[model samples]
Target: MVDLNAALRPADAGSLQPTAARPPARLQIADVSLQYGGKTPTLAIDNVSLEVANNEFCVIVGPSGCGKSSLLYLVAGLTDVTSGTIRVDGRPVHEPGSDRGMVFQGYTLFPWLTVRSNVEFGPRRKGLPKAEYRAIADHFLEEVGLTAFADSYPAALSGGMKQRVAIARALANDPSALLMDEPFGALDSQTRTVMQKLLLRVWEHTQKTVLFVTHDIDEAILLGDRVVVMTARPGKIKAEVPVPFARPRSISLVLEPEFIALKKRILGLLHDEIDETH
Candidate 1:
């Protein structure tokens, strides 16, 4: 069994100073709820609250229709909440801002642009110089291992490759936090695994706070520092499980007994929620 103590110990203080010194951009969600209105008003999320610290990789998981993605969208300011508030570093989030970056399940690339241009889109919109934005795009393209495909259009890339570009484009904006909604759900299992590992590498290197939503428990366990489980529709926080396995993790870690045990615990929590709904 891996030593939980060692796994949970804080990263070296000296080595972490660079990221630590940056202004705090902790994500805070307080008493948040979302509803849709028409002839039939539907409550999708009910008083859900979550906080993701800067540089933390937090994943949300729940059974289908549990509003996991809805909660993320609320934080991204893509949709307004019916009640409560969300703040980043103490500033209220009223709408989408450059401070928050989003990546969706679909590769939302600009079909007309080459990979390089797509990645540079955000920086360019911010009025960055041509040379400066190009350099930023180049840096993230290399970070995502797509330097060779910089000139390729979205249609020319594979699904996994397209998602890599999506990731690069989001990072190029240098958002305070990254909000991803099932970014790899459409990929094959092998490709999904590769992308998961690639994301960990980039997260560690960039130290960006991430709030990712997925239905895959294994992906949650493999990638998150803490996995937030939500209950069935009108979703609420069911449990928060800390992933104590050390970082620099591999896919093989999933086969470990500890990993399996943790998976079972989370599954039971999800099952209980599903059972309640039925």
Candidate 2:
């Protein structure tokens, strides 16, 4: 098992530590819905309610057009809900606040910025002192094992490395919740496996509330403490499956009997959705 804290430096003075005893943040999405309007308005997401426990890694999975990502957007405060509310740590989310950090499938890094500078952008933008943001950037880059590439630009990195930078950049902000939308979907199988382990290690170390959206059943089952499967368009919760595997999960767990059984069950549920779509 990888020990994430082993290689990292201590948090800067007055910064939150990975093992700090702060109250873990909880995310609640209640009766949420989203509709895009014009001549013919379309309801993208139906009445959906879900609660993610403090520091829990919750993964959402479904077929394409199921509005899994839309639900994520609502939580990130990047889109307005047609109706309903989203709360973070009991406070209603009205706008995109630093409390929520998002990592999209595309590496949204600034092409011209070095990896270190890109990670520091959030803190600097918030008017943090140079020393504080520099420390923040260094801590996260080290945690992601990208310290050596601090001066490297995005265009010079591989897909996996770019995503690593993206993850580092998100964490540099020290958000209570981390929202990821198919963050590893674009990687090849080999690289994706490595990234998964790295992500689990990061999640274990940071203890941030995670809401990850993915289409792969295996990936969802492997990462989430609970996996919520959605129905077809105008997405509503179809089923919520709890992952029974132990923590510090490895890719090899996918070969185990328990993992195989859970995968089949989720696949069965998804197949029904696909049938209805046709």
lDDT of 2 by residue, 1-278 (tens): 32323212212221212234323448878788899999999998888887777888989988899899989998999999999989998899888988899999998999999999999999999999999999999999988889999999999999999999999989988888999999999999999999999999999999889999999889998998777888899898887766767788888999887778778888888899999989
Q: What is the TM-score of each candidate against the true structure?
A: 0.92, 0.90
lDDT of 1 by residue, 1-278 (tens): 76554333333211212244333448888888899999999999998777788898888988899998888888899999999999987899999999999999998999999999999999999999999999999999999999999999999999999999999999999999999999999999999999999998999899889999998999998999878888899888877776888888898999998888788888888899889888
lDDT of predicted model 2: 0.86
- In model 1, what is the error at residue 140, expressed in angstroms? 0.6
Scored by CA lDDT, what does every candidate get? Answer: 0.88, 0.86
Which is the leading candidate under TM-score? 1
Model 1 segments beyond 4 Å from truth?
A: 2-25
lDDT of 1 at 258: 86
C-alpha displacement of 50 in model 1, angstroms?
A: 1.1
